[model samples]
Target: MKVVRFICRILLGLVFIFSGFVKGIDPMGSAIKFGEYFSAFHLSFLGNFSLLFSVLLASAEFIIGIALLLGLRMKIASWAVFLFMSFFTLLTLILALTNPVSDCGCFGDAIKLTNWQTFLKNVILMVPVMVVFLERNKFSVRYKPLGEWVTLGILFTGILLVIRYCYFYLPIMDFLPYRTGTNIPKAMEIPEGAPQDEYKTILYYQKDGVTKEFTLENYPWQDSTWKWVDTKTVLIKKGYQPPIHDFRFTDQEGNDITDLVLYDTRYVFLLISPNVQKANTAGIMQAKSLADLCHGGNCAFYALTASPFSEIRNFTEKNNPGFPFYHADETTLQTMIRSNPGLMLIKDGTIIAKWSYREFPEVERLKNDILGYAVTYYREKRESLTKTILILTLLLTLAVIKILQLNFDRRD
Candidate 1:
């Protein structure tokens, strides 16, 4: 029983930690999911607070996981975990039945689960949840309340800082289809053997002042007495879909330039803004300067947005941003980058690099040679090193705290 309890606790802790970390790293993505839920349930009034709810939920999950893994404050942590799991399990059950949102966004974009899959996952997790809850009292090790609270306070603060950094910049780890190194065209390809969607075609017809629904097999096409009212095609089963299915680029004149951009061998600088009206003006100006720099070199530049043509015209008239604005899906742009105005560098159809508005490369920095390989290589290397260091520092700090806690308890 004791071994079972230990394994259950560890398993639950790791699952919670992973779930929290993924959502925390991409809080905006979670917020968007929350908005979808609110809209679906007619509770859209709370849409403004989605981000706050997202951060708080993620933080609570992380804190509970840490407490469980480190065997700290078991009484309270166990209760919290039990309640949290119970609530979400019930919620997922409802979602599975209703099928409002396609993906629950429980693991952010790191993992995608269908409504039924999410409910099943929650149901399976209940076994460990019950085990931990039942053994909560047995693992209730006494500790100095002040010290425990202080440690949690510090940890929570660090989590908030990391979330904020990712919100302003971009997620340290990109899980979207448009992540760096992805070949845009290749990601959108559909394999020849992919399964096609299965649909049930229902025909509505009226005869003798009465309407009846019939399948295509039964529908009397030869009978002139029956009049066809409408036809409904219902999807019975979904099929394989490409990751970048929604990706497209439409110019102001309603011309498709997706292939033109993807086939270009020269480096292409793309400024993506989901909403032109909400985009930062300063960031747009910076993008314009970057566009100028690209034009001077062997590169191309274009701006893609989801805003309507009227809004685009208004924005251009007001700011005079000397770059052409194309159209793409709003959600697609959001998936590409978190920032209001983000920059992407693509070469030969591959996403070479991406940057949030705050980190837009300066014109002077690339004046020497805009397409120089060394410049992008070192930048990517530096950013990768920074992420590794930050993660290691946090882990080391937690390890030290756990060691000190154990040592202090031993002395007692």
Candidate 2:
């Protein structure tokens, strides 16, 4: 029983900790997910506070996991875990039944699960959390109460600093389809003979002043007296959707320039902002400066946005970005970059470099073969992320070892 309790705590604690950290690093993405939930539930009024809410939820999960893993204030931590899991379990159950939101985003973008799968995952996780809660008294602290408190305080401070840095700069890792090195044209392409959405058609007809629904197989379409009212097609089964579904660039005159831009062999700089009205002006200035930097070079510059023509025109007049303006879907722009005003460098339809407005590349940084440099920079970034993850895992492993050692020591 004691060994089982130990195993449960270790497993559940690791899951919560990892899940929390992933979502924590990309708070804006989580906030956007929150915004989606708000829209689904007709609670857009709370959208303004979404970031804070997301950060808080993620922090709580992380802190609770740390507390349990370290066996600090076990009674309180166990209770918190129980309550948290219970609330989420009920929420996922409701989500499974109603299907209001496509995903609950339990593991952020690190993993994807359907609503039913999320609910089942919650059900499975609940068993261990329940065990931890019931065996709370088994957890004992090796350090003094003050030691645990101090450690928690340090952890809290570190988390806040990391969150603040990521919020200002970009996330340390990019997990989206538009991440550096992704071939946009390739991601958007559907292969030959790919499965299409299977839908069943239903027709509504009014007969004797009564409207009745009929499937194609049993429809009374041959009868002249049956007047057609409406037709609907229901998706019986979903099909494969490309990662880049709605990516297109349109000129001011609504001419599609998607292929032209993607096929360009030279460097192409894309100034992307979902909504110009909300983007920070500081970033806009730097991006405009980049236009001048690329003018004499064989580079093509374009500002792709989802804002209306009126808004785009107004921004153009005010910013005077020395580049042409194009249009894309707002959601696609968001997925492309988290920053309100982000920059992407593309060549031959492949995204080579991406920068948040805060991290706009200076001319000095663009000093080499632009494509090769961007690829190198992306590789270095990945390596850095890998190192950070490794360091954290090592630290957590040490902590677990110490905690286990303390438990055995106490028994002796």
Candidate 3:
């Protein structure tokens, strides 16, 4: 029973910790999904507070997870985790039955799950949750109160700092389809011999002022009494989905410049803002300053937004951002960058780097220190890999310590 309880506690704690970390790292993504939920349930009044709620929920889950693993506050933590799991399990069941939203945003974009799949995941988690609930009262040797509190406090502060940094700057880890080093033109291409669209063709023939429908296999093409009136095609299922769909840029005249921009060999700055009105003017000014440095070099800049062309014209006239404004879908821009006035760098059809409005370097620093064709691929790769390694190491170390302590208590 003790062994079973320990395993269950560890398994459940890991799940909660992983879920919390991923969502905490990209709070904006979680917030956006929460907005989807709010809109779906017609509780749109809570949309503004979605981010705050998401962060707090993630933090609470993580704190409970830490408490469970370290055997700190087991009574309270077990009850909290059990209630959390039970509530979400029921919620996921509802989602599976009703199909209100496609994805439940449980794991954030780090992992995607269909409603049925999510329900199944919750069902599997319920096994360990039940074990924890039953074993909640067990108490033995554990970390000192001061040490446990200090460790938990540090973890809590660490996660908040991570979220804050990612909010102000781009996420330390980019998990989007358009992450750095993705070749734009290539990602948008559909591979040859891929699954084609499935459709059912039905022909409507009018004879004596009466319309009759016929399938391709049964339709009479040579009947003299039947006059063809219309053909209707019903799509049965979607076909191949390219990684980069809905990624077109258009000018005021409704001319697409996707190829022109993607094919540009020189460094190109892409100013992405889903809503121009909401963008920070200071960020736009920073973009302008960076654009000034591009003048004498092989660098170029363009602003892509979802705001109306008229509003864009007015905005540019009022505060010339030093770049031609183009159009993209609002959702696309938001997916491209969570920040209102995020900046992206591309070269020769490849996305090279991305930055939030707050992270762009100063003009002098940009020109002298970093702007000479900064290849961020290597830097981002090394940093992300190192961070992943350290986090995994720390988690493993803590797990080993917990096991040794449990063994000592058993011997005692």
Candidate 4:
């Protein structure tokens, strides 16, 4: 029984540590998943805070795992594990039964689990947690002193902060649909009837301090670059023609036009929204506000929906969004952005920014982004370079600690 308990503790601790570490690497992805839940519940305010909460949750998992593995506080660690697993099991079961989301995002981008798979995983985890909790008092282990606990708490907090910083500055991992992905161009189709202009040029600043310009036509290794950059979307360069099959649908006025195109020189705000009837009210309100901001800036704002013209026109008129509405294929819109109400910013046919419904930075906040594009771009680059180094360092540190503890145990 003692051996079984010890083995279970190690297994549970390792599982939690791995799960927590993977999620920590991509806290933003977890937050994005949480945002989906918030959207489903019509809780937009919680959306912005989801990422922060996700980091904290992941850090807790790591701390608990460490405590369990170290045998530092058998009673408390066992209880914590039990409670955490219980809550997670309930959440996963609800998610599985309700099917509110396509994915539970259990393993972040490192692993993908369907709703049923996540539920099953949680159920399996719960069994061991329960066993540990019930047999916790049977294992004789002293709790950590207050000082050690405080130190552990501080360490966990620091880890969470570092993870959050990595996520905001440069995502350590890309698990979400909008993560710098390879299929960006194909996912966001440029309409055929859209006007063509000069191809937008990319000013590449190489690490060797050489600057070169490349257009989409002359862009070297386009596919590889797309994959390397993990570009979720790109602007359709001016003067570059889309495939002839890129058809534009008509509006209520019978005008065969697309609401906004990548060819335009002006900044374009493309709101790829689900049907208004199906969308959250707060999301609809946010879209309206964004449209108002675009109108104030004389930026082209187009609300693209998969609904029929009559339904969209009526919704627009009723909402008084003041922006033109266009039609797009439902699947196309979904592939463009994972969020039900997704926004994309394009300038001169180059995609500048994108946000899920929950992560929508207000229009006023965008000025800072525009002004600091160079800094932000470089920061993202640096963070990407450092991600592998940081992950490896953490793994090595954990392994060394475990080895030292095993040596101590053998000596005892």
Top-scoring candidate (lDDT): 1
> Measured by TM-score, how close is model 4 to the native structure?
0.50
lDDT of 3: 0.80
Return the candidate ranking by lDDT, descending. Answer: 1, 2, 3, 4
lDDT by residue (1-412, candidate 4, tens digit) is 8888888898898887777887787675577678888987689889779967888778888888877886756788998999888888888888888888877777766777878899899888787788799999887644325533644665576567667655544344544444432333453566677676633445442334444555555655643433222222345554544322233545656666553365666667778775666665466668777677666665667777788877777777777666676777665564455555777666655556666666565566554454255346446666866886687669756754554444334322
Candidate ranking (TM-score, best to worst): 1, 2, 3, 4
Which is superior by lDDT, 1 or 2?
1
Per-residue lDDT for 72-119 in model 1, tens only? 777888899899999999999999999999999989999999989999
Top-TM-score candidate index: 1
Worst ten-residue run, lDDT, model 4?
Answer: 224-233
lDDT of each: 0.86, 0.83, 0.80, 0.66
Instruction: Write the number of the candidate with greater TM-score, choosing between 2 and 4.
Output: 2
The TM-scores, one per candidate, come to 0.93, 0.90, 0.82, 0.50
List model 2 lDDT by residue over 19-101, tens digit each: 88878888888999999888888999999999998899888888888887777778888999999999999999989999988
Local error of candidate 3 at residue 304 (angstroms): 0.9
Q: Per model, how many backbone clashes are there? A: 0, 0, 0, 5
